[model samples]
Target: MKQAVIFAGASVQPEQQPPVPAADLYVCADAGVKLAQALGVVPDWIVGDFDSLGSVPEGENVEPFSPMKDDTDILLAAKYALSKGCRRLVFYGALGGRLDHTVANLQMLRFLADHGAQGVLVDHAHWVTLQRGGTAVYPRRDGMYFSLFAMTEQCEDVTLEGVAYPLCHGKFSNAFPLGVSNEILAENAVVTVGRGDLLVVYARD
Candidate 1:
């Protein structure tokens, strides 16, 4: 499957990182250029204000935006990638920056999901993604903690298994945080939602 990988400007620890995997397109958001280059990525597009770059790199691959624009640089890069027909996308350096930017980046995952693409937000302590409605199976990581949160008004018939606390056919709402900090016990864990979508956060302290 053709996919895109984007790098943003967020603080990240070396050890607690997730791989961006192979992608058909590589995009960088301002300072994200450094991270992308460090990962040996040749970006097809560099979308952002030239501030982080000192000056725009000389290439047709560059897409400059006004720093004062309403959208964040990373969001702009993502939209561009999607427009170019990338269906599966993953982001690095997208969290741990300004709190508001981090939250906005997470919200972008929902936008991608609703538009028929998959978006994953990978950071030092967690890997997060939005599920419109489906099952997600995860291979266990010893120190990882799993949590589920309703992304819409409500998520119905949620089920979780192979974890320390298992639930069946549960309903969750945005008003309350009913699923948070559950342990992974075995080789794998499965989460299923019968209606609506939820945010699945696989985290560690």
Candidate 2:
């Protein structure tokens, strides 16, 4: 299974890139081409309306999509990545933009997850996801914090381990802040959910 990374046109903070495993393909979405170039990484494919791309990279791999297309640039990039046989797609610069775009990107998580692709949105201070049924683990960092927010109407049978506050088979609702500001206690923290999707945000304090 090939791994792919997609970059979107959002404000990226310093030290936002993690040590991601080298991807078979790197995709740039619209202005994201400039972001990739600034980072000195040439993407395998670039897809977007090109309105935001000031100078197109000198390559045939750059494919321009219509600005009036129904899908967002990032979403188009995700589809391209999947078409290239990528089983996992990691996203960068996916947050801190227009609030509508950010929320739309979050919804894209469910789209990818439903299609059997593992999608993660990494930003300056946090890694966010709307995860379905699964067991997620967070490796320990010196001063990292993990928070989970219920994205759907409710998340059932949720559990948290190795944290300042722990939960077991608990239910979380979208209207409350029941799972906010939890700290890690062990080298690796774990969260398990039996049903419903969770919006998890992990950050460094």
Candidate 3:
């Protein structure tokens, strides 16, 4: 059961990076090499098309791809992590900067979920993940905001606990953001989905 951490291009400065996990491997995707280096991280592999890299990093394990590829660099790095038998994947630098890239990384979370590998996009201010037919629980904290969106067309039998607006066996629609801007009121909060998928966004602002 190996774990992996991937650094992406759309991120903040190294000094402002989040607390990273201790994993078997660390990866750099395109411009992520810069972030990795700035944080004094020697990644096990450097992956991407090298377009945003400016200059190829000095490394032996470089997995280069074409600029015309279908997947984004972060997704490519995630695939590499899966190929190496990683069961848990955490992505940094996948959020912030461009809205399109952030959306793309959310899709990568779906890919990880479909493959039975858990993945999350994390930063100092936000933590995002995908949930499908499962339950996700968190230790509730005051001033933190939690929201859920239907990842599929709709999420069925959704349950919420310990939140300002709690729901039990509720249905959420992608066309509507009915589950937005909720706050904690207890020690713990749980979100359960009996059908479909949900995009969970937890933020502290």
Candidate 4:
């Protein structure tokens, strides 16, 4: 499965500027093109309306979508990546600025996960995702915290390991904040969910 990295035009912290080499297919969403270029990584494909791309890059592989289109720029980029056989997408600069856009991007993860694709939203302080029924592991980083929120009705049979507080077959709901502020203990921490959708967020203090 080919991996695709997408850059979105959101407020990014300085620590998040340098491009990380995790995906072969790189995509820039509108203004994200400039951000990627500034990071010294030219995108293999640039997709979005021209509104944010201010100045275009002189090259092929740059496809422009209608500015007045129904889909958002980030969604367009994700769709294009999927069309190009990308199985996993790592989105950078997806958080910050408008709360509406941040929530929209979070919902997009559900779409990707439902369609047999794995999508992760990366920002300066958080890593967010909708964990369906699977096990997710995070390599330990000192002073980092991990959180899990059940976005749906209930996340049943959830388990957590290598954390300050552990759970065994626990059920979580959107109305409750039971899974907040858990710290990583071991070299790696594991989270497993049996049913419902969960939004797992990892952050550093």
Candidate 5:
């Protein structure tokens, strides 16, 4: 798979770093360069307005955008990744710090899904992704909490198996968090969404 790994937002704690897989492309969003360096990754491209970075970084790899831009720095980085033909994107440091930014990243994942790609937001303690009207199987994690939410107004014919609380063809709504804090019971969990999008999250304590 052609994958891109992007660094954005606050630096992750050393102990909280997940097992990051190697990607074909790497990108940093402004101040995210600091976190990229911490991870020993040399970004192929750096995209941002330089506001968070204090000053424009002196490098030919840096792709500076105006601060008055409509999209966020991370979103710009995502666009660059897509332009490079990367369909699987993993974003580090995309959570925490500002609550609004975290929400924005989630929206970015939805955007990727709409564009025939998939994005995963990795933070200090969470692995989040989006599922669009399809089936997904997740490997069982002994102590982790698995949760799913309706990203659209309604997700119809949602089925969940191999979890502590199983659902059969249930209609999920964004208005209610009915799929929160479930645990994987079988060797793997199967989630099928007949319509609409689903926001899936795996959290560690």
Candidate 6:
């Protein structure tokens, strides 16, 4: 499986830019082309409605969409990457801007998950993703916090291990943030969800 790195239009400080990962494909969505230029990465594909970008970019790979379309720019980029056979996607500038766009990007994680692909939103201080009904392993990071929340109404038979507060066969609901701000105590922390979905976050303090 190949990997794709997508640049989104969300605002991120210079200090908040994470190290760009190597990818088989690089995508820029709308104003994300600016971020890509700042990061010194030339995009393999550029796509968007050109609203945030102000105008269509000059490139043969640039794909333009109708501004009235339902999909967000980042969504269009993600779909383009998927069509190119990239299974693992890493998105930069996908969070921290308008609240609605941030929420919509989170839903994109679910969209990737449902399609048997892995997608993550990353910034300098955090990594966020969604997990379906399955087990996931996370390695401990010094001075970082691990948190999770039920994306569905409830996540059943959720088990957590190697964390500051561990749980076994527990139920987590979206109404309460029971899994917030936990520390990883072991080399690897494990999370298992028997049903529903989880929004997992790893944040730097």
Give candidate 2's error at residue 9 in angstroms: 0.8
Please identify model 4 stretches exceeding 4 Å from their true place. 55-58
Please list the residue runs of candidate 6 whose C-alpha ends up more than 4 Å from where it truly belongs after superposition: none
Candidate 5 residue lDDT tens string, 1-205: 6999999967567457776679999999989898888878888999999898899888899989899999999999999999999999999989876888888989998899878899998876788999999899998866789999999999999999999999999999999999999999999999999999999999988
**Candidate 3 vs 4: which has more TM-score:** 3
Question: CA lDDT of 164 in candidate 5?
Answer: 94
| Per-candidate total of colliding backbone pairs | 0, 0, 0, 0, 0, 0
Alpha-carbon RMSD, each predicted model: 1.7, 1.8, 1.3, 1.8, 1.0, 1.0
Which digits, one per residue and each the tens of the lDDT, describe model 2 over residues 52-170?
A: 66655567898887678899999999999999899788888788888999999989988888888878888657788767877988776656677888878999999999988999999
| Residue 91 lDDT, candidate 1, scale 0-100 | 92
What lDDT does each candidate get?
A: 0.85, 0.83, 0.87, 0.84, 0.90, 0.93
Q: lDDT winner between 1 and 5, please give it.
A: 5
| Per-residue lDDT of 18 in model 1 | 68
In candidate 5, position 133 carries an lDDT of: 91
lDDT (tens digit, per residue) of candidate 4 on 145-184: 8888988889999999988899999999989999999988
TM-score of each: 0.92, 0.92, 0.95, 0.92, 0.97, 0.97
Indicate the residue-level lDDT of 102 in model 2.
93
Return the TM-score for candidate 3, rounded to 2 decimals: 0.95
> Over the stretch 1-205, how does candidate 3's per-residue lDDT look in tens digits?
7999999998587777777879999999999988787877889999999898777666579988889999888888999999999979988898886999888888888889888898888877888888888887877755669888998999999999988999999999999999988887878888899999898888887
**Clashing residue pairs, backbone N/CA/C < 3 A, model 6:** none
Best of the candidates, lDDT: 6
What lDDT score is found at residue 41 in candidate 3? Answer: 85
Model 4: how far is 85 from its true place, Å?
1.4
Cα shift from native, residue 101, model 1 (Å): 0.4
